[model samples]
Target chain A: MQPYPITAMALCNGMGDSTAAVLAALRAGRSGLGPCPAEFELDAVVGAVPGPLPPLPGSLERVRDTRQTRIAAVALAELQAPLARACARWGADRVGVVLGTSTGGIEASEGAYAHAHAHGGALPSHYDVERSHALDAVLHLARVFGGGLAGPAYVVSTACSSSAKVFASAQRLLAAGLCDAVLVGGVDSLCRLTVRGFAGLEVLSSAPCRPFSRERAGINIGEGAALLLVERTGEGPARLLGVGESSDAYHMTSPHPEGLGARLAMERALQLAGLVAADVDHVNAHGTGTRQNDSMESQAIRAVFAGAPAPAVVATKGYTGHMLGAAGATEVAFVVDAIAGGYLPASVGADPLDEALGVDVVTARREQRTRAALSNSFAFGGSNCSVLVGGPA
Target chain B: MSAPGFSVRGLGFWAPGYPDLAAWQARPDACPEDQSATPKAELLPPMMRRRTSLLTRMAAEVAAQALRAGGLDPTGATLVYGSVYGEIRTTLDLLAALLVAGEPLSPTKFHNSVHNTAAGYVSIATGSRAGNAALSAGRSTLAMGLLECAALVAAGEGDVVLVIAEEPLPEPLAAGRRWGPFAAAFALAAPASSDMPATTCRLEQGPNDKSLAPARPAPAWLADNPCAAALALVDALAAGAPARVALEPHLAAGWHCGLGAGA
Candidate 1:
């Protein structure tokens, strides 16, 4: 596949509400995990977007309000200029919007259910499920960007790998000549459903997550948004070289013990990019710190880079927790920054590396220029996507 | 604009009155008073079947049927699952446990709540490690999914199993959105080598002209769920004739689909 240039990116995750803040926090190896909000009875910590959020613009007032859309609005706000520029270059109709979200406004459903359970009556007026459908972000973003109403606008939802797969879908749309530019990324905000869901799975860590570390317990559910404007235009700061996806068909929750799907995704991504493990200088692993995920991902990474100089492995989940559907795009932002900034953000929570894992999990920041980097995002249901982004060679 | 299309090697469907492609084709005008009982998906191993939701079951059932009908290896094709809303019942179940019962969610139910649950189960059932994508574009989900399927085959990525499924949303949540429970699957291959003579599909980009539409009238459920649009395409494929569906108003550009005699 021909590489597509990424002209602009905007991200607002738990690590920071702005790109500059996120990059600084990454450089400083800071952990954003904090005590779970008092409202939730969970004992675990979480990575939440701090402070109040901005209200939706008057133009988007018609759209419903949910933590998910509000967070997406914040992220899209950062890309207003870039998005407008892209729409100008390629008429608004030529620009498509592809978003990923596992729980789109589930919190709204929770609130509606809570109200009905208490009052025992008709649901509230604003409690329309269709409005908060998982594809709402696509609609909201499209409306904000002016015109994707009748274009190739859709939502890719495959749990955690949702957003990463959006890149592949966007690339296909471009290769097939469906669109000239794509606003692609993901958004998932904190919701009781996701929080309690992870807790029920018993994978919610009581403290900050420790990815690829010996003492790692599980994950801290988090939320935010990451949006990138990709175009078939000239070379930019970063480019999406390739995207590969696979399914383990192994388990609904647990991944394949040998990480067969993960390995296949990485190999496929490398094959698509016309590169190999040797060409990769850094790896942003999908390390959620769960025993099964870390163990299997380590094995997969070792297999993909075997007999070659393996790239420095960095897991940013320690800094931002596991953002679920949004993690793919949010983490890719860091990979783009790593390629441009010429530094590897340390896997902050990984202190004593799990020697048994046999993978070089970076625990300290490294200042080195890298041309190619791979980002891994493996989701429940054995869905896996690996995206390669790097500086122009 | 429309690009060259793929051939419909095989087709599987589950609707109110139709249990399979042949059954549906047998009576194109039939519409059951109520949705049929969800299939048990005996094809799935007992363990896998136990873990699947009704939505996942419908998806797997149709996918397997398509592969079997086409004489294609399930392991060799990529799976593209499309839906407007995913696992709404499971989501409501988890929410009920949390908000109404004030109890922890059942781990099994929680795991099944993701949108890609069907895709995951489909891969596991087929023992396929091939790439799979789950997409939703609201009312145009089926149109967008077909576009994706056509692109994969055109790019020589691999044969594809395109499945579009949408079950009705639960009550209260279902009050405003009135979607019918339906599932449709297609075994698609690059038109250059498909064996289905009467069901080859060619895609080309064109104007968003409402003047060109499927000859068959859309079912009543088309208003509720977007994937019902497949019924029109299925009608043409079943009749073994030529048809063009204007995919505009749903897709970026208008898509002209031609069902023709195979070479």
Candidate 2:
């Protein structure tokens, strides 16, 4: 196989105080989703961060310009000090920034718009053009590093595939000698828009999301960020072996029933890595729990790995809920963690796999050494991106 | 064994108040209309038109023009659509509804607000079951689109790929941005023969530093502008001569230049 090109250093998933809650859920094979008793009319399940968000530090506040940015700020706070030290060692210019987000500061925009309409006039001076757009999050990170002028800063928003696409983009950029290192990750905050939007789609389950199960229902809306520092080096660190990106353009809201796009994306990644289907040890399925999505993905997996023994499939969305744009990076972090920890976390809430969807869906935590894993991310508009992560060759 | 690369074959563009290619080329400095009505839905079938946002409509129209100019059908062709502000109007509307009415957001609008919405819609429209991709990199949206399109072609993913870029003048977004809204697309394919035009596009890092060089005459200056690269494509094809054009890099501080010449 052509060796995986990009390596990942220091991966972190920020679930606020809910990290323990989620970890428990993972250990107990439970889902973090529960009833939302909020004033909203919708009766839906939410994979909400278990507790209050950590307070932003004064240093961060001075630079914090928006609420969503602040959410991203908090999400990255755990890694900032370590990342800073790493940047110093790696040279700031060599480090690039690629952030995937569905709504960078949409929450802030909604707030500002509300304030303006109610009171008339303009928003705070800081709520400028950059803050309103999704790209601003990456720009903010670039500024924080004092390396805005040094390297590339990109923001990718391909809906649910946004964060996953960032991984692919980062790999390409690094492979092409664009940057020696890149901070490839995603950040998204819960906003009324996303919550109501999902509710409108009638895909939000009032109970904890059950993925890949006969009784599986719908997905829970959740938000947080996951950050991974990827470096192009000859040794050490978890290597990013391959990436496949394709758009189905099949439907705006629904995936193609045949899973043609998903299959193509997975096949492309394996081909890029010069490996056959059998090389993959684990499948981190998109598994959003929606009927069409889960069923379609199951068929795609069955088609790709058909005759050969299917890889153990697990869906992490049951734990983190669907982080939307951040889902790709957040799930990738889980894959990296699984590799680092030398175990595969059970597909929380998965039980009695659907009869029609023929695949070995992992339900209980299993301790197994994994050399390579494929992480799948499918977004609206049939945009599918898959990333292959593996141990160093 | 060599890596794949993109080669431009045909180009087309459409903008408000600019009906055709000739009109757009003649009025390079034409500003966007202060206000323009949305095109009538009858132009496209309701099933196809219902899902298209303003940006998607403009993109589809421009892509069709590009295919016609290239004398190719987009059927079974790969596609790449790039826009810095993807379906911003729809996004703004959704956000506004959430803020004011606290209403249930439209699922269609929410889904269509994604970066690949237009590309996906185009594929559905053309029944092009080939690869489709979307990219964005701030001001260099078109450049990035071109880069991805070239990579796909080189990779042997498809014989021909469509690269389309569109930005619409939503009053809110255009309020402070300098450039006017426009749509440009190109049908890029592998060279059919030695006589086909040869094209090379390269992306590099550094700061944009073009002022030191003396400005060329008006015609030459216009030829060098990156936006004019689309026009240079048409010129090169028409005049059957080699052409070199410079484009501002999307990420780097320097210029990204392309050189093409027909055999």
Candidate 3:
């Protein structure tokens, strides 16, 4: 349960392109979601990354070129210098890659389907399904393109909790001495499948999402990528103390009614981190703004810190939207910002907090020393993961 | 370099031609078209049973068999699932629906498309709250999956059921590799005293020469099946011999696994 150093980090999402930019926007109280375009044929607001994405370089285009890889390339480029230094420190063969994704470059498949229709049900030969749409798309992108990491490498795809679970895998690899350093990341880009799929489920909000508010609507889906370098000998101002995982064993797409799995994951994370409820300074919630998720998460937070004054809980989805697979890593980036900047971002858009919820939903920034924080990301099939982060001891 | 050692308490296998390890070992070289009663899936309730994809049913069936063989309790075990592509049948259906107008994509299919659908369903059916992980590494999937199982054992997770599955790939997506549906599960734990046969397993980073090849040649019909790599280890266990098996022959470098006698 010893803390691992976050030696280097790169983040690109609706909030901002770099960790610093994201932190700045968090401090300034800004919303990154905008109205969804008519082409999407959806009414909800979305967190689409603006501007151009860097193209895949050279032979990577043959197997790893896609919207997901392009989005990951943006963040991986920001992480180049530090990542390269770490990879050099530990030979490429000694570093591992564990990436999480919900729908890996699925936009390519959508295009392929349209192309198949035009060509009488023949998919375009130029596309590589394994490289682009499979769960390992980003794993190959980061391993092969992220300096050819040759150690243990794999991809985790458990819906929304996809990327957050990567940290657990990294922890195990480092704990087992399989790698000196591991690059753990998550990347999911917007595609017709998810946008329309959620629409069919009636969980897409026409207006900006409002987490934990009585008047809350559903989620505003987002797209982006976040990567972090964690080392066994990690020493720095930031640290990943622990990761706790659990399954609801209840339902797919729906959380346990009483937040049972969420509470278990948080309790397990606390156990791993060697911390008590009172030690936590803040909680970055998996507040997807869905009525079910917010209520369930609130119940879990209150239960985890029962009898003690629960820490300030903030939902930054208003800033980053719901990045789905990328939410965990990106929101954890927000926690790093808080640890370094000595302040907490208010739960943006959480106005007139829902009375039934029993947790402190921070409505304004509070400048304070945040020594430890917990970040929650739960996904379909009741897959739950909670990561503990804090300033160096 | 060898990692910490674990033991395989039980093993299970399912494929188009071979329904179980006994059948596979009996006729490894024969390509049988005999229709066996594919999994009855008695554990799954009626409503949930209707939603399972072929991949999920295949995995759950093998998982149940492994647990029964190992005489292990599902409550105390963790589930580790690996697949090159997960729930492709459900995903393809979702994609096709997306291409049409007015008709909404089936929410059930969309939810079932997750790579971990099998783990989730099996966990629920078995009442396993021990947690689960779903992963993939393309050709290196089985190797990475076994490594994860070893790591979990070393991390004090007690017992783990490692399930590796791959449903048949559709055209263009197959990319010219003619692999059929395959799924396998092995219940593993720390070396313990028991009357049942067990294979001592350790993951090592070394050359491929030490790897064991199945005594019976694999049927030529199914080629490049990811889960097929585990057959060598299963064969070593069936033979009750100490040997090294190549989890992945060509892709993941130095994934030579050693199996031997165990309690």
Candidate 4:
């Protein structure tokens, strides 16, 4: 199996004003979630970063929507230095950009729609296809990094697993010799539409989410962005060991009762890596804290590991909430950090493991060396993806 | 990169105004107002038909047609549904419900609003207990779906794979008169015999300087070209030789697909 190299750094917003904040959050096992004000009509808990998110520069604001574009812009800014250095080292024209996002600029469009209905005018001339759809984030980021000159720019919006699939796409592109370096990540922000949409699904938990716990409820919606720089070079920060993607083709909203798709995805990833289940040091489960999802994933883990000692399991939704399409990429950043730091952060709200679940849940932070970790991202419509990441061999 | 091409075992389509390829090619008069045809309802069951968006109904109908055309059952067939803007009308409705009624949105509508909703609905309707995938690539929706279909077949996951591409009516705000609504489908399987025609499609870096050796314009450029380009390929294969069809470049990459008769 060919290995895809991770040649640069990963960045997020809540990791402490900077990359150090992310390190601090990991070391202290702190969650970035906080209460969202009533203005957003959101009563459930949110994993929102504290502080004012300044609007995008007027130049960029002229062409795009606000809410998500701001988050995408900030995420790009956070990784600018590392990305620029990587580009300089690998040639700017060799790098491509791919982003995973569900709600590209919908929040802004919703506002524009309301304005058009009330004022009876055009939808702010800037609401073009490049600005309103999911691809806008990718295009905007490409322009920011001068990668439009390099290769194609794409955005994947396969629900929650959107970003995780970007890693798979990047790997395939590299394997196909499409590009030498790629920017793969996901970004999503709090929007009334997403919040209300999930709320309508009756899966939003008012209290903090408890993943893998018998008493756990539903998930808390969060908003953030994460980006990883990838290249084909052998030497780098980490390597993408393998990626597995599958669609359950089961129910639209519900997972398979036996977690067939989840099991297939994990097994495929393991097979692609030529590693057994025991080789996986830790698993970042797609434990959304929802009743069906948590149980389904647990069943899949047990089916894969069987009688062997299950890998240490950690759920980051307690910290970052569920970022939907962005959840996969954001969680992968945590997995990369776990390998770099040699420890598994506790699942913040997970207390007692559900007796029905057959795997060990890491409730409290533990220090242990991990060579590799598997990150899982499951979406609505039964889209499932698992990515395996490991340290330098 | 030299993976063997899949066999084109069968083909099908469901489109506005036209229920089958014959009816579609007849070029019936367009609707006076929106020029959109009333979707054919007879293709799906009543229970599975309720509240389905134009995209879902079109995708399922086309997918089923492909399976039937191939003389294969929908059961256990791997599905790959590709679309650019998925169920836009339903998405608009959800947003409207949030703003006006402040009413809790319907879970059904919310689920269908996702890009992969059509793939899931097809699975449920066909009772397909196998792999399902939904992908989106501007202009390359069909190509992407075909790529995955070929890969899955190559990986030995299925005997045949169904690749379906459908685009919902462009809302006034979204499409701005750019492209119209259409759905196309093809059933691909591992080559059964060496004599069958073979085709290889790939996404390549753009601006090829090579002179056009009888290059065909993208399907979108062909006037009144709905469901015809797919049929054209079928015709081209029957009159076997080598032919290349250039799809509109997506993501700034030049993409040209080659189809040829093979031994």
Candidate 5:
């Protein structure tokens, strides 16, 4: 497959709202984990976006005005200029939108549930189920930028791997001459269902998450959105070289014991890029900080790049918590920023790396000119996606 | 907007009236639709059969029908599942548990509630290792799935098994909406394949006003449920002619899928 250019990107996560702010925090190895502030009954730390989301403009007044859509609106606003430029470069009909999400406007539904419970099971009039549909984010973006996109607009919702898989579909669309450019990203907002659900499963860490550490506990749920404009003929700072996807087919929740699916996805990604494991300079792992996830990911990494100098293994979840469906694209944006700035962000929370894993876990910021990087996102239901990004060779 | 290198080789559908392609072709003008009862699918293993929801079963049944029609191996075909509303029953169950009892969601419900639950179950049942994608785009779902599947086949990825489905929302959540459950599947293959069905088709984006509507007055379910729009495509295919379906109210153009004379 041919590489596609990443022309522009916008991010809003726990560490910061802009690329500059997030890069600064990363270079300083700052942890964005803080006390749980969303009033969930579960006791756990989280990486929530600070401050209120910027209000949606009047143009999008008809769309559902939920927290998730508002967060997506912020990212969409940032990409407006470049998106418009792309629309001019290629007619609006040639530009598409592909977004990923797990729980879309679910918090709105939860709020409605709360209201209904308080009033003897009578729901509020404004509580429409379509507002909470998983496709809300896509509709919100489409409604916001009504005439700018007229191709392949949809939402991919495969739990956490949702966004990363968007790259695969985008590549196919471009390679098959379906669309000239695409607006691809992911958005997920905090909701009681996810937080409480993870807590019941005993995977929500009460303390800050620590990936790849001997004492690593579990994940910290977070919320945010990440958007990028990918085109076939743009002079962008980074390129999506290849994407590999696979399903675990083992357990619905727990990953394959041997990380079989994860390993296959990485190997397939490297193969598609026509590069050896040694060509990768950095690894952005889906280290959810859970004991099972960290352990399985470590084994998978070791197996994929066996006998080669290991890439700088780092996990950004500690800085932004796990953004669920949005994690893949958010982490990809974070890695692209690191590559452009010529530094490798450290894995902030993991200390005293687990000796059993045999992986080089980055613990401190390092100044290195990274040429190619790999990002992994493994979701529930055993879905795994790996994306390779790099600058011009 | 031309899908120059792709073709739709097979099609399958399931709903209140239609059970599969053969049954539908046998009686296209049956009134009030078939309303035949959907039997328990024996294709899946016991565990999966038990775990599978009615919605998932509808999708898988149609997918199997298409795959059989195309004579393609499930393991070699990429799966793309599209939906308007996904697993509404499970979603309502989970929400009720959370709001009424303040209890954690059951692991089964949690897994089943994901949009890709049907894709997961299909892969497990057939042992498919190929890539899979599950997506949603409201009423344009079937059109979007057709576009995506065409792209995949045009890229020479592999044969694609595309499934689109929707079930009615819980009465409270549904309010006055009258849509019911429906699912459709298609086996889309690249041009000139030996196993290809007679209906070799390609999709192109064309004038918006050229968009198609149901030939007859649509049933309440067909009018409201997005996935049911797939029946329009089936209707056109059964007529052995070229047709287009409007993805409007969303996109600027409708999809024009044409079948070759062999169809």
Candidate 6:
């Protein structure tokens, strides 16, 4: 798999609403997590984009207006000019959009359902699940927005690994010649369904997350979006070098204790990149902060690197909270910044790293020249995807 | 833009009346009005079985049948699941619990609410370490799923199982849905090693060749089912005849599928 150039990208998380702001936050070693919103009864930390996201451009109201879409709109707005230029350079049909999402406006249903329950199961006349809860709503929004891209479009919804896997899918489409350029993204917004769901799972931490720490408690869920435009053309920050994926076949909600699936995903990613374990310069760990997840991920990293001074590992979830489906693509943005900008963001909240885990989880930001980095995203259902991004060929 | 095609190794279909290929072929267009009986996911052990939702159960049933029918190792193939309204019943259940006062959300239901739940259960049941994906393209689900399956096989991801399903929406949420409950699975492999005669499938750019997608075998004008588009191709596979199948439910997606000898 030859490297594909990432031409343009846009993303917003609790850390910041733009990539520049996010990078600035990373460079400053700031955390975006805060006390959970009062509206939600859950007692936990969260990473929510600041209030009042721009609404969908008017005409799309009937079929694609959603809080998730509004979150996506922020990213889409940032790329409008470049995206439109790509559409012009390559015919609209020659561009494709593939998004990854877990909570697709399910909040739309939450509000509607609340109204329905109060009114004896009668949903408001204005409610439209097809438009709002369409799990692929963000895909449609991307397709229609930014001057209308009419191409092969779809969505991947494999929990946290969803967006990371998009690189591979987009690569396939490009290699198979379905589209010349592809807009790959991940979109998910704060919703009671996700917050309450994590609470129900008993994996919600009342305090900020501490990845790979001895006192690690659980996850602080977040909402965010990341969009990257890839082309056969050059002149971008990084290249998507390789992608690898695997299933744990172990449990529904738990990862394999040995992290065999996670290890396979990393090794396979290296194999696809025409490199070995030694070629990896940095690692952006999933590091969900849950006891089981952090412990198992460390084991997997230790297994792969297998030497003193493994790759510099930073768990960004400590900063962004577990953004669910959007974590993968958003992390790739950080990896790209690490490679091109020559910096490694610290694993915020992981001050006293868990030495027993045996993987060096970096706790301080540093200026370092990184050539290639592997971003790991593992999800419930034991789904794992590892993506490698390189500085230049 | 026509894709390099693959071979169909086996097929699986399930619905209220038609539970298997044999049943489907017996009455190729039998969309039974009485939607009563459900798919029994026998491959899942009781413990795993008890935790699954109807949508997951339906997906497991068809995926197992296809893998077994193809004479391929059930755990050996990569999986691609395409569904618009995935794990809907589980989502509804979670929402109901969350909306109720004083009732805590169910952990099991929350775990089951992920769109990839079905793909995960199937892979876990078969003990497969291969990668699996759950995706959707709205009305173009089956077509997009086929594209993914073809790409995985082409990329040497291994043999592939492409499953398209959508469970019937219950009550208040029904208005947003246009499809009925059904599931379909197609087991696929890379083309022959040499120039040997075999059934093939190629997705091309054009208006669909509607001649191949026969009217679905349903009692009345039933709503479209996610799996409904594959009926014609399944029949052609059963009879070893050449046919061009329309993978998209609607005709205007600008993609065409050919399935049969040299198709």
Number of clashing pairs, model 1?
8
Chain A structural similarity (TM-score) per candidate?
0.96, 0.89, 0.96, 0.94, 0.96, 0.97
TM-score of each: 0.95, 0.84, 0.96, 0.87, 0.94, 0.96
Calculate DockQ per candidate and list them: 0.71, 0.35, 0.69, 0.37, 0.58, 0.74
Positional deviation of A113 in candidate 5, in angstroms? 2.9
User: CAPRI verdict on model 5?
Assistant: medium
lDDT of 5 by residue, A1-393 (tens): 899999999888787776566667877888777876655554668877776777655455446677788778777777878888888889887998888998787777777767776786666776677754446445556535634577778888898999999888888888888889988889998877787778767788888888988888899998888888899897887899999988877777888878888998998888888988998989999999998998899889999989778888989998999999899999899888888888888898788888788889988888988888989998876789999999854
Say which prediction, candidate 1 or candidate 5, comes out ahead on lDDT: 1
| Each prediction's number of clashing residue pairs | 8, 9, 0, 3, 1, 4
For the predicted complex of model 3, DockQ is: 0.69
Residues B23-98 of candidate 3: C-alpha lDDT, one tens digit per residue: 7778776665753335555557767877897789889878887888888887778889999888887887787788
Off by over 4 Å in 5: A39-42, A58-62, A117-122, A132-134, A142-147, B27-39, B100-102, B208-217, B245-252, B261-263
**Per-prediction interface RMSD in Å:** 1.4, 4.0, 1.4, 3.3, 1.7, 1.1
How would you class the docking of model 2?
acceptable
Clashing pairs in 6: B29-B217, B30-B217, B31-B217, B31-B218
- Span of ten consecutive residues with least summed lDDT in model 5 chain B: B210-219
Summarize candidate 3's per-residue lDDT along A268-324 as a digit string, tens digits. 989988888898989999999999999899999999998777789989998878898
Per-residue lDDT of model 4, residues B73-186, tens digit only: 577666777666666778778766776756888888888888777766766666665546566655545544555555556555554544444454345455444444556677
What overall lDDT goes with each candidate model? 0.80, 0.65, 0.81, 0.69, 0.78, 0.82
Candidate 1 C-alpha error for residue B237, in Å: 1.8
Please name the candidate that would achieve the greatest DockQ relative to the true structure.
6
Residues A1-393, candidate 4, lDDT per residue (tens digit)? Answer: 467777655545443435567668866888877788455766778876555665666655324646676667666776777666667776766676767887677777677666556665466665664456544444555456443334445566778898898887677666655557778888777777778788888889989888988889998888777788888884665789888877776777889888988998888888878988888888999999988998999999889888566799999888888988789988888888788778899998888778788778899999987887889998887788999998876
Question: What is the Å distance of residue B260 in model 2 from its true position?
Answer: 4.2
**Docking model 4 quality class:** acceptable
Candidate 3 displacement at residue B160 in angstroms: 0.8
Docking class of 1: medium
What TM-score does the first chain of candidate 6 have? Answer: 0.97
Q: What is the fraction of true interface contacts found in candidate 2?
A: 0.41
- Relative to the unseen true structure, what is the C-alpha lDDT of residue A377 in candidate 6, on a scale of 0 to 100? 95
**Lowest summed lDDT over 10 consecutive residues: which window, candidate 2 chain B?**
B212-221
Cα lDDT for residue B1, candidate 1: 53
User: On DockQ, who's better, 1 or 2?
Assistant: 1
